[model samples]
Target: MEKYMKNLTYESVLPFSEQVSYLNGQVASKTIAQNEALSLTLFAFDKGEEISTHESEGDALVIALDGTGEVTIDGNKHVLHAGQSIVMPARHPHAVFASERFKMFLIVVFPKKGD
Candidate 1:
């Protein structure tokens, strides 16, 4: 068997909630394959939504695909407009809030470790 030719969409994934932090009615999807080193995800939030404070064990990158909002990371708040993104380092306190309806693509990188 071979890899590298698979396609994915949000509906193809399962739904899970995390207390780590997120706005009400938030939804997400992630894509992964065997031995995949990184995970790709899409997140959607309704207006006035937010993601609670939390830290990731792996590095995370978030790209805003639409809408506007403010993100507070490590006590700093920054505005995010369409086509903007931010990388949150591992173990850093971070959270997100949507001033309006919002959507984003997330990439979480996981380096392979020697057995």
Candidate 2:
């Protein structure tokens, strides 16, 4: 059997927020899964760190794991705290900012190869 996920412990109960660590003045990411159809990533952001506006080919879901973050979609900004989630639609311009040290889990679902 092939493992579909990586960088995670199997058969253990653990907090997802602890999977990644915040770096001083930097954004760090751990990729759990990656393929043509989906992507699963965990990110830790230091205060003031951000991902500039960009568009994704797939719909991306962001779930706050710790602290706080600001999500900007189509020019509108939203604040997310631990346990909160938001979806960014495919092809829409979006950005993420860390108002304070924060952690988040991101899941992106891409369309099938043939529509």
Candidate 3:
């Protein structure tokens, strides 16, 4: 099998664009291949857009591809900027806000088998 595939661009996945339910942004995610948990997304948000507060079911991570933002965890606020990334533990209440028009990626990973 090939080691990689063509990169996914936002314009290439136009039909899948969807709004972030809890926040005032949108996302476009694409599974790169079937064998890995890795994926990519193009997220867009209006300035001051905020997602609804919530928690995740499993370990997750996020990367700010292009923009400024903030994340709140358990009432604590932390600033996020382009090229920044963070890992979030399962079930922790968190919220994300776009201080300006923003774009990011969300990643969910499961433990490898027989670790």
Candidate 4:
């Protein structure tokens, strides 16, 4: 698996939200885990920060951990706050924007054989 945060040990209990930090005018991301079938990432976005619309090869699940944000999927916008979550379907256009400084967990799952 590919790890983003150096020196961070795995299989230990810790706060997921505190693992990544928000930076002014920038989006910060930490890859928790990455493999052929799945990828887990943590993100912190500053107010007004956004990820441009794009398509993914796998389905993406975004869960808000703190503050507010918006996820636009296939031209529709959905507002989200702490404890909220939304799924972006594979090969569909989607984007993420922070209404305020926010933290989130993103899990992307690739299609498996015989599914």
Q: Count clashing residue pairs per candidate.
A: 4, 0, 5, 0
Q: Which residue runs of candidate 2 sit more than 4 Å off their true CA positions?
A: none
Off by over 4 Å in 4: 1-8, 113-115
- How many Å off is the CA of 62 in candidate 1? 0.8
Task: State the TM-score for model 2.
Answer: 0.97
TM-score of 1: 0.70
TM-score of candidate 4 against the unseen true structure: 0.87
lDDT (Cα atoms) of all candidates against the true structure: 0.69, 0.97, 0.63, 0.91
Residues 10-93 of candidate 3 have per-residue lDDT tens digits of 445433233322244453334433334443444666787777689865566777766687878777887878889887676789
Please give, for residues 46-94, the per-residue lDDT of candidate 1 as tens digits.
7877788998766788888777867788989988887898988878899
Give the Å shift of residue 40 in candidate 2: 0.4
Scanning candidate 3 in windows of ten residues, the lowest lDDT window is: 14-23
Worst 10 residues of 4 by lDDT: 2-11
Candidate 1 differs from the real structure by a C-alpha RMSD in angstroms, to one decimal, of 6.7
lDDT of 2 by residue, 3-80 (tens): 999999999997889999999999999999999999999999999999999999999999999999999999999999
Better of 2 and 4 by TM-score: 2
Residue 18 C-alpha lDDT in model 1:
25
lDDT of 4 by residue, 1-115 (tens): 8555453567788876899988989999988778778888989999999999999889999999999999999999999999999999999999999999989999999888665
- For residue 65, model 4's alpha carbon misses the true position, in angstroms, by 0.3
Global CA lDDT of candidate 1, please?
A: 0.69
Candidate topping lDDT: 2
